[model samples]
Target: MQRFPFRFAPAYRLPALLFGVTPGTARVEVDDTELRARFGPWSLRTPLTNVASVERTGGFQFLKTAGPAHLSFADHGVTFATNGDDAVCVCFHEPVRVLDPTGRLRHPGATFTVADPPALLAALEDLEER
Candidate 1:
């Protein structure tokens, strides 16, 4: 499968670093069967088949954080995001594991910032058609 790649928008760096996130090192790659995201030391991959939903979002708003960029974890759902604004949230059919910057495993779904979200979505849709 060919790798469809996209960089994250530039605006997320400072906020991400402020919350202890690696910041400014975000990228995504979509292949025929899975979607992968990387931000500094953190990485996540989910089989396309396991994805239950995907949505474009304005990202976290008014949500105070002890650490806005902390690794995300959820037993039933996971959301991996780079910045607190402008993100793509993915939900999976079953609990999935993700690797954080510390290489620890966490479950559920993941989110990431994309430079061109619509293009990513279009790529996913194309993959679904295959």
Candidate 2:
């Protein structure tokens, strides 16, 4: 049994809820958090170790996570891995993107290859608007 500690602000609750995920599901204690999220039908879980925090700016909230690592979004039905240091990966359902630290698009369309936090934040902003 493995336990991962994560902190999600109240703002993100809506997005999680929209995806049919409650706090209980988000804050789960399981053997493999990533695996559980991947196999689960309607849940999106990222390893706490991979995630840093959610950044909010200009009426938008973004889920930010460190990249160069594997990630899964069951609701979005996407699974992919990144390999970059200052890369930030953003997954809004099926659409996933990666950005560099300066907030420039490293990779767009289909798959992402960078992991910059600023880029991730930008994507989050876009999602928040939707």
Candidate 3:
């Protein structure tokens, strides 16, 4: 199996109970061409061979990329991976925070809030342009 050269922490703050130390990185793949186009070039930067699975719950969607790890994000609510494998789920409440097992800040806080997907997408697009 191929390995990624860089490490990745949750770009957004996931609930403490969901995240843990030893965060893993997965190669981003373009399984859905339409979705990739919608997401734009930023999606290309992701490793294309590592995507494991993608799922949606009440208001959130969990993306389980390669490396058998998971990532959580919120759209209308809180969406994240429930297990270490490729299983995503949505929740009604926001996650606690993205911290290691010891509770340390991993990635920076998200600029856009989960409640607003359009704004968040716009902000993400803006960030990509920068």
Candidate 4:
């Protein structure tokens, strides 16, 4: 299994603690069959095959992606962020439900502020080649 911890900015750490999101609690883990994430109380799980693509991105507005999971109003993408710096956006073949409780609202992509963006991206890419 490949695991990546979330990057916690010094300024954001205190706020994250309130949501029960610490470095130990927020992480993304990938095994042969599944990709699982735990960000405080929110979690996202999907089959490895469901992953379509991954890209590195940044420049986040604090209000939009500071603490818990945030859903994009424009794209319906969910962001599991701890910091505003580096993040990897993973697009899925099929949209997954998150942010909404009814299970009707699904997101086509998810962005994670993992500690190592390149490593996480490379890991997913290597899985694709296998």
TM-score of every candidate relative to the true structure: 0.63, 0.28, 0.22, 0.95
In terms of TM-score, the best-performing candidate is 4
Per-residue CA lDDT of candidate 4, range 19-111, in tens? 888988899999999989988988899999999999999888787787778899899999998889889999999998777778899999999
- Residue 113 in model 2: shift from native, Å? 19
User: What is candidate 3's lDDT per residue for 1-130, written digit by digit as tens?
Assistant: 2121122335332532233412232221123221111111111122222222232213223343322223334332211222222222212112223223443423212111123234324333333343
TM-score attained by model 2: 0.28
Per-residue error (Å), model 4, residue 83: 0.9
With candidate 3 superimposed using the best TM-score fit, by how many Å does residue 72's alpha carbon deviate from the native? 6.3
The CA lDDT of each predicted structure is 0.56, 0.31, 0.25, 0.90
The candidate, 2 or 3, that scores higher on lDDT is 2
Q: Please give the distance, in angstroms, between residue 103's alpha carbon in candidate 1 and its true position after superposition.
A: 10
Tell me the lDDT of model 2 at 121: 47
Quote the positional error of residue 70 for candidate 3 in Å.
9.6
Error of 2 at 94 (Å): 19
Candidate 4 ranges with C-alpha deviation above 4 Å: none
- Model 4 clash pairs are none
Summed over model 1, clashes come to: 3
Worst window of 10 by summed lDDT in candidate 2: 106-115
Can you rank all candidates by TM-score, best first?
Answer: 4, 1, 2, 3
